[model samples]
Target: MARLPSGTAIELYESLDSTSLEAKRRAERGVAEPRWIVALAQTAGYGRRGRQWEQSIGDFAGTLLFAPEGASDNLGQLSFIVALALAQSLDEYLHEDQIRLKWPNDVMLNGAKCAGILLENLGQYLAIGIGVNLVNAPKGLAYPTTRLLDFIKDVPTPDSFCARLDHHFWALYRIWRQAGFGEIKERWLERAIGIGTEITVRLPNETLSGIFEGLDDSGALILRSDLGKRMITAGEVFFGPQP
Candidate 1:
């Protein structure tokens, strides 16, 4: 609705299968400028590992398609950046203490998930897709979920919320582009959950349990285990005691 940051373009879809898919299509079509593709509704949205991401009509689903900087190895850091931005944008309504970020990109509200960030790495372009439960949350999910309206008296419309999100995202992005993830990592850790606590991380082949140490410089998870410390680049982390 409001003017986006300089040179940024946005496309609002009444309905789309997925914003990330549209991001890929735009990249393939030789669109190089930075853009935001937001879908008011998704027929078949997906999260990490292709898990279905359900979005109610009032929920938020959008992806920023842009050429990413840094080597492929370092691009994962952007997930933390996006998470930070999301948390900050929601900070306006939620109390400062109500927000916590799970490793990589999950935004926790009152110890439960209220938002998620999924990064789709296209060869030349990176799609930073974000979804937020602005008004209503799905039930029967594996994990606990909450919505912004439940906690705050006023819930922003999806358009205004995304505009606010754009403000925070670009501000943090500029810092990341200049100073790297050092500052970003610190802010993330401040809002991160499960730090210095026991958690389970499930990899493709095996699962491991360990103390949740702070992140490494490059943003790989620093996990301390009986076997010794390990660096995990990617995995699903579960907090609290695991059976």
Candidate 2:
């Protein structure tokens, strides 16, 4: 509809170094139309903080190259939008309550991680990279992990999932553009995990222990720790004392 951004298209590849990398390449070459750069598998995929993200065949590996006209400053909010949209898309195949959104950019199914999102801000372009465990999940991760086939009787293929994800993403994108982040914060909190509970936040220099209060208007975390309530714009979170 007119609510969604124009000039957006999907470019599917058999394999790539990384969809996000491809988006950056396209941007470098001045290919400016918004697009979904997707790969069946990635050779050099990455997660938050440049950790290697291994992609197995049959999983969802894609990046959305979105050009936000007036959103260069408030780009952090897009992660919550992506999380909400991802949860909504996956909810179609399972009970809605089974899907939960983690702060920043992770999707939980049955209380285990099933998907993660990585955002890259490139001037006017934002490359939203996402990986979902469709058929199987990797082992030996610090936290628990899950997959779609674990719950769905018939899991959707990557291409099929892409269509659904695109549909839901645009829906939220419309709401965000029209109604603003108050509505987004409300919706995200409805499906959010660990609100009003104790959690750990891992920063680059140090870690902080706090109670997960909620998100502020700017999408930064509001943690209530011994140091009192403070806003944390960037950090990794844990639900319990680990380490």
Candidate 3:
């Protein structure tokens, strides 16, 4: 029950295939900007790169739809903004330093992925989907996974965490809109993992191995390989010695 921006609309559902899909539907129907869609259970949830996202009964599955306005040029930066906000909310229940934000938008807790974020562009609008494993984290994933309840005895419900996330999201969003990515980049790097380490980035058609340099001004990952410096805009990253 936290305060949202003016003209913001909220839609709650007990179940949905995916909140991001619902938000896209609303955008197609010409719903106004700044709408939030939340679902207690998602039957067909998904994450970035079209990977399946498992939604526990009480986990948080929500999407925020908003007009790009003048931000279309640098819209991709919002993923980092959202990640920072989500990390801040989780920091309330978990140790702030324990939370690490992976490149792009994955939130890692104690080296395991605890949450994921997806951004979908819907023409006139954009939908940002957020999934947090509050009570349960699915097992047998490619990478290590974790749940909030594993560390915190008194875990926060989906809605309560969403409220806190909403507050932090808007606060960071406002700063991004006014001050630009300079501050956001600085803040994100503060919590970033694998800054100067050997890593591999799996692209759609090719794989790149390099030293994880850092992030470029536009948020692209800077990879320093024997060939030279390369800026990666999209790819899956793996830290440590590549297999």
Candidate 4:
């Protein structure tokens, strides 16, 4: 195994349903922070709003566990922090300006979804699950999907990719823990997609159409509509057309 820059420990698996579930189980058994669980393949995976993340062959699925100081009390914004870390890591392998953050936890490349993030709490620790489209992508998905090989041409192996992510994530997490979400907010805004564009937000209760203003420090999407400004913490955002 390649050594990570931040001395993070990695647990690699051949296959699993969800790395997040495995990481949470480890956390319950007293696993500490800076630990990662990576799987070469996943039989089942999940995305935002309980959507199933279709895992194709030769893709990347992993979960990074963190037990920050007072993590139980400051768990709300951890997901955004992890998203920010992924965005930065992706920048290294691709053009920096091509990677964009989509609200809560999605990384979009050139307006197509390239990666997704999911976070879960394990009482005392937090697990951030990430799935990157490396070699294969689901066909005819609702949203456009892309693979890293499509852009990188010669993509790295799963092990090398995870090691690089561990290094970049640790560096970003250090800044996040020290400076809070303010810094992340600014960076995310810089690479945000659909900002100032009219979009449809599908909420469980009702559908709202508004201009994508940006995100708040709490990682909520700030939408400006005829009814005035609204902060959305969770919802499905459709950019050009509704599906």
lDDT top scorer: 1
Predicted candidate 1 versus true structure: per-residue lDDT over 129-240, tens digit per residue: 8999987888998899999988877788777788788888888989998998899999999988999999999999999999999999999999999899999999999987
Q: How well does candidate 3 score on lDDT at residue 14?
A: 93
Tens-place lDDT per residue, model 4, 24-118, is: 67887896447778888887787766778887667888888877654464565766667777777777788878888787678888888888988
lDDT of 4 at 198: 90
Candidate 2 clash pair list: none
Q: How large an RMSD does model 3 have?
A: 1.7
Model 3 lDDT per residue over 133-197, tens place: 98898999889999999998898877667778888988898898889999999999999998998
Candidate 4 clash pair list:
none
Residue 85 shift from truth in candidate 3, angstroms: 0.3
Candidate 1 shows a clash count of 0
Which is superior by lDDT, 1 or 4?
A: 1
- Candidate 1: list runs displaced more than 4 Å: 1-6
Q: How many residue pairs clash in each candidate?
A: 0, 0, 0, 0
**Per-candidate TM-score against the hidden true structure:** 0.96, 0.95, 0.96, 0.91
Which ranges in model 2 have alpha carbons more than 4 Å from their true place?
Answer: 1-7
